[model samples]
Target chain A: MLKTIKLGLIVTLLLPALTYAHGPARVKVIQDIEINAPVEKVWGIIQDFCSIKDWNPQVSACEITEGNANEPGAIRTITLENGQQLKEKLIKIIPEQNKIQYMLTEPNIKAFPINTHGSSIILTAIDGGKTKVEWKGNFYRSFPGPNPPPELSDEAGQEALSSFYIAGLENIKKLAE
Target chain B: MHFHNTVILFLALGTSLHVSAAPFAYITNQGSDDISVIDLAKKQVIKTIKAGHKPAGIAVSQADKRAYVSNPESKDISVIDTDINLVLKNIPVGNGPVGIAVSPDGLNTYVSDWYDHTVYILDNERLEITGQFSVGHSPSGLDLSPNGSKIYIANRDDNNLMIFDRHKLSLLATIHVGKAPFGVTVSRDGQLIFVANVQSGDISIIDGKTNKVINTVKTGLFPYAIAHDDSNNRIYVTNQRDNSVSVIDLDKCKVIKTIPVGEYPEGIDIDIARRQVYVVNWFDDNVSIINTDTLTVTGEIPTGSGSRAFGRFIQFSDLP
Candidate 1:
């Protein structure tokens, strides 16, 4: 319990510095996929904010740290396969629009190479009981200076986030279909 | 004879448009590296002009028929000929040129370098660097008084607004404001100055004569820039994080209403003649048009991707 408290203190101290540490330019990544199942099935697979661990193979585990799942202001800490953890907060969830919006509470450069990120997932019903899932992320590279190393560059951040979103969308398709 | 008549008609239409044209908003899209020229009457992107890398800040001068765009990543400024809707030149500036302002007479342009703690002055006619002066850390937004006597700059890192005498090139006063002040704007009559505080989520109103903050008005989350509607006695502030615009009633000196806009609205400007406010949304790549009289968002014009357009971007129709 003491170790956990220390870690929380460290995170609290580092929040402002990490949040403002971003490059001049912002990068956007959008990916979408059509599933064979209906909108309800697709929403069921990803509606819970903590369900990312079950759908995305890259996320090893997830735990709700604050508030409840699928509710605004809910916070979750997800551990990646590489052991890096990312804390995210749920911004909003619109059931009528089939949209879920969330943002990174604290950036983890080791896992995503991004300073700040806001992501949204939307479900659209098609004509033949099919659902289209669109996932989008707007973020900035973690490296604050110009000419960052390839690992921390904007391209790297974009590639990592697009792949992550695509992987989650593909997995959701598989589970829903 | 038919061709001659067609030419005559074309020339007459062009002359009329030149005499009475609707205002054009130059929206700088950082992601697309271009400016979406939106004709206010049409309420759509009429043209796309390529600018320097990562164009963010903009200032339009109707008197000179030119628009200046600050490209922070490129370390340069793009000069656009408003008549032809084309870039005339990309003048290299300081280390990171972000916030820019043009004089009321359209004779000079002031650019604030974010990385370098200095503001560079350019001769509008010759388009040459004429002067430079140092300022506080991380200067983000800047504006000139209507009479062109004073220049107000918001130094974001220092959390203060610096008022400079334009003629003497000297700092008149540095007023401490809320945390992370990003945009500085002056009223039409030059009676007050509004500084948008991003972190504090409020605006500090400074009296021009005293240079002292008289009132603090609360805004939405992360207010980035401000636009004054003098006729309505209100100011519109774009809240970047909230994706909304806060209308502050100057008479009451408080927030009157919050109007929802596009995602991540970063830049805001008012067209006084038409009584409309244009808000450029960075994330949604659109401009939300707010009817000033009604204080409602009436239309959304789709612009290029990552439309920041940070500074004063509207060219009023009445200007020479």
Candidate 2:
């Protein structure tokens, strides 16, 4: 009975470690570019939520469903290149300040179920002749889901997310310039 | 006319002779929850003294023989008696104390509160909070001028360095640096301040006299800490992501060598007496000793459990 109790205690201590072996991963990417245009000009192109499909290469289509296009609490649906649809809510938006922040809300990607996606874009005038635009995103993932998937490694998932964001930003820069 | 001439001559000579000494490197070890005492004599961790919870940043006063260590979780500064290898007091500071620096006269210690975005000034003699000044968000590393007239703080969230007049506590300037500036150290001659841009993986060299960024030198991936060795005219930067140390020659403002170390090298300290460098690796739970002259790893000292306690900062003293 003593040996059995000791074994039970040992299993209890190791249970969490074994159960949480597979977890989600986080990835953050920041990109900046100096556009030879005024802040107003660059901001105008980025302010329209429906125009993301025109400028962003990866985003096939996007539409704001609720609230003003550039206002907080607005919901936007975006379709990726592979027909993966993602729904996001505008958490904060300030046109005068040339800042926009949004978080992914619905139609979660199967590879990153325990992930939160947030992105912020800022535009500032530099030397009156050019505008400096910065785009940054924070992607977080966690493990130990009810049903764990073998293909959801942290490194591979984060790499894919970072590359996707980079491609989208490059396309935006090309359109703005 | 002759009396006036004599007085002026004496003042001029005194000012020329009052050059400040080079600052000794101080590092706080978060893994051991203690401060490793490095004696420049042998260039080794002579002793490890207990401090508060998760000691991260360290500031030392060569004149007063006291070291102030910021304990982020404890929200206080652990005052260690340099001569005694013991924590004399844990003075309550602001929320999430991270960066710490002492004034030139050794009469005051300023600690950067990470959570509150404020710098708390502690009166050394009284051992109490004297005043506090607002800075940018998530202020982490700090450096004060040799004359105690200015203090520079690195705000991590804002990605900028803030300058403040030490006496009036007024804002001086805010210089935008690269992504996530975490550690800062001023040169001994008071001419340059080097800031480690963690996310950018580079070091920003600020012209101290001009208050401008002179240049940004690339280091290893995720450079988190920097230390200046005035005697050798070299700057040491610890790269957390690459687990390496980049030695920069101050004159050329270029990296001279990269010395690989254990996993996740985060904090660094230099021993001027023996011309050695100590780097703390967070994941490996050991300190890599490097010969500054040769720029190579000489030895390694294991601290504790091989967990990510982030053996973050390090400091050296002559006492123990």
Instruction: Tell me, by lDDT, which candidate is best.
Output: 1
In model 2 chain B, where is the ten-residue run with the lowest total lDDT?
B305-314
DockQ winner among the candidates? 1
User: Which stretches of model 2 miss by more than 4 angstroms?
Assistant: A1-177, B1-27, B38-48, B304-320
User: RMSD to the native, candidate 2?
Assistant: 18.6
Q: Give the CAPRI class of candidate 2.
A: incorrect
lDDT of 1 at B167: 91
What is candidate 1's CAPRI-style docking category based on DockQ?
A: acceptable
**Interface RMSD, prediction 2:** 12.6
TM-score of each: 0.86, 0.59
lDDT of 2 by residue, B138-230 (tens): 787898888888998999878899999998899988999999798888777779988999768899999987889999999987798887898
Recovered native contacts in candidate 1, as a fraction? 0.22
lDDT of 1 by residue, A29-100 (tens): 999999999999888888889999999988999999999877898999999998999999997898888999
Where does candidate 1 chain A have its weakest 10-residue lDDT segment? Answer: A6-15
